[model samples]
Target: MKQKKSSQSIRWIIEVFLFIVAIVIFFGGLNHFWMRPVNSDLSKGNSQSRLTQKKFNYVAIGDSLTEGVGDRTAQGGFVPLLAHNIDDSYDVQVKSQNFGVSGNTSTQIYKRVTTDNKIQEAIKKADLITITVGGNDVMKVIRTQLANLSEKSFQAPAKAYQKQITDLFDYIRQYNPNVKVYVVGIYNPFYLNFPDIKQMQDVIDNWNNATKATVDKQKKMYFVPINDLLYQGLDGNEGVTEKTETSHTITNNALFEEDHFHPNNIGYQVMSDAITKAYKEHVNEK
Candidate 1:
């Protein structure tokens, strides 16, 4: 009888040990699957800005877009908006300096980045640097080639722009090798008025592509494309990408009414949001 009681107790203890092991294995598997980190591709879709939890110095250097040309709010265009966005998203203070020239060309921007002392100091201090160039460079070519406009007309200029960017970025890296640099691309504000001229958009595409390619060749450099993003109406409706020559006059709701060239306040918001998305998606731990 005593021998039978000992056997029963031993069996009960073994059963309890197995149950505990099973429970631990089940929870361990659940934790592994639930807490797995994703590190492959953060560049595809919208990603919530990770909490940086630190202060950063932001430097804005580019063209009219950087100058807040058409912003009715009188605030510095995307620079301030982006500062505010980063401040909110990362829970850190953003001290931004705007070095955007109203109509600076790529060559002009290169000159400043290479020679200007103030911009050099800013670049040295910047944790994030955003560049808005190439739009005026594209416009320069368009103005000179409007009479005989074709895709080939932009080839040489595009190459020159690419070289300038390469050299410009090279110079920037010489001083601030590790600072993250984001370059904003050009867009076709004329697409609405001249839908028949497919080559017009082609020229713009060529410039943007050249700029993106140049940026791709460098480390810690990124391109923020705004061409297609600006094609949508402020109402979230599709803008006229496919317009016939006979199509009625379509206005880009995001563009400023006064100039129909620069982005309005809402347009600046769009730019800032796009910047935030790209920054969050590609930002590495620092």
Candidate 2:
């Protein structure tokens, strides 16, 4: 009886060991066959290096707008669309790299151009450079003040705005003297007003005018007035309505992200179209 009991105990141990071994193999196979590839694809989708190849002809530099804040598709931001459009329109093999970071202002970009090795290299190789900045600088300050007071109380700092704009232009010229610079004007975000929002629109107009002046002063630079493109009636007779928000205006949502400032997918496409059109015009003029 004792010998039989010992033999049964040994068999039970073997069975338990086999069960654990089978579980390990099952999970290992699942990961290798299924989960691994999904993870790899996601990583590739978010990879920044994939945006531009070495020595691209066109380069986009600025804040979240340039980074494709509004685009939901992972295929890439407007930079890719701009590149493809340029190729089709100009019949030139144009490649583009986007060096945009969320919440970055002109000051940040100025520092980046000098200190960031990757950006420096991209600027050196690029024949065309597009920028969308100064919006964040103005918006951030306005939002902070508006949080506690009425919209009428909001006033933009003229001196600070001038300095930032000047510094950004100076930095770009100092970095690459020959590269064509296209400065994008700020889009109107207060079309659908909460309260005291019209003042925000006025501030945006001033900021855009400053940007235009700088571009006008430079020989190789041009200002792409996206504000005019997105907002209907450049005569300032009407503001963007909620009905036209999806196609023409930016909204306060995740599509626009938490900031309620950046463009969603639709917004990014509009920007891409404007830049592509400008590039085509420039090529034609040449």
Candidate 3:
């Protein structure tokens, strides 16, 4: 009877152990797939403004490029680089706050601006705002219509992007009425690599044109073009290929990082330059 009882207790322990394992797996999967926290990590830098008492606050907002994803240096991508370039060139005390979250679409950024307290606070105090979005919005359409390509593939997404982008600009203006808003245009990551997928370039350009139109109607908002700088001359329909760095040359897509989705360090630097130049031009106009 004692031996029988011992066996039953062992079975109960095994069952309890399995139950705990199941619970762990359940919650783990839940968090992994669904429960991602929606907050941008706020990082503040550059104290030269403190010493000089100038106090120029620059806030960068948007997706992974704004978060500095492909920058191997991990220096928070083009946001910080733009800040440093502006301060160094202009000789002004600038404080840069990066509120960029990777994989965030235009709608997500609009939500962050309206909902996230930290991001809202930064925007409130920002002297300038640089936004890089609409890339993921375009990507969503591409992914859903991978096997099928058409002229109408991006029409819906582009319209959705226009609304979200308009709301984003409105939110920024609501928070910081006087600050300069620079909207970065999306580049075609697949342009040089997937020449056959000619629809992507048109999709990107259409989205960018929509974005430019939105920004043009708003006061203190400027659209910065980075698409032309990233992979120029690919024209989508051109059945052309260029030699890549690798001996196994595939296509002329030399601007993208190893992921072939995001920009490389060079690409990000070019982005920084473009934004900085725009900012300088804006400053001169002011």
Top candidate, metric TM-score: 1
Q: Give me the overall lDDT of model 1.
A: 0.73
Ranking by TM-score: 1, 3, 2
lDDT of 3 by residue, 108-159 (tens): 8888889889888888988888898987776566456644435486788788
When summed lDDT is taken over every stretch of 10 residues in candidate 2, the lowest stretch is 34-43
Model 2: CA > 4 A from native: 1-56, 143-156, 193-196, 232-260, 284-286
What ranges in model 3 sit over 4 Å off? Answer: 1-50, 233-256
Local distance difference test, each candidate: 0.73, 0.60, 0.70
> Clashing pairs in model 3?
68-77
lDDT (0-100) at residue 31 of candidate 3?
Answer: 28
- Candidate 2 residue lDDT tens string, 211-285: 688678876778888765555433343433354545544343322443334456655666778877776677544
1 or 2, which is superior by lDDT?
A: 1
Sorted by lDDT (best first), the order is 1, 3, 2
Residue-level error in angstroms, candidate 1, position 252: 1.6
Better of 1 and 2 by TM-score: 1
lDDT, residue 252, candidate 1? 78
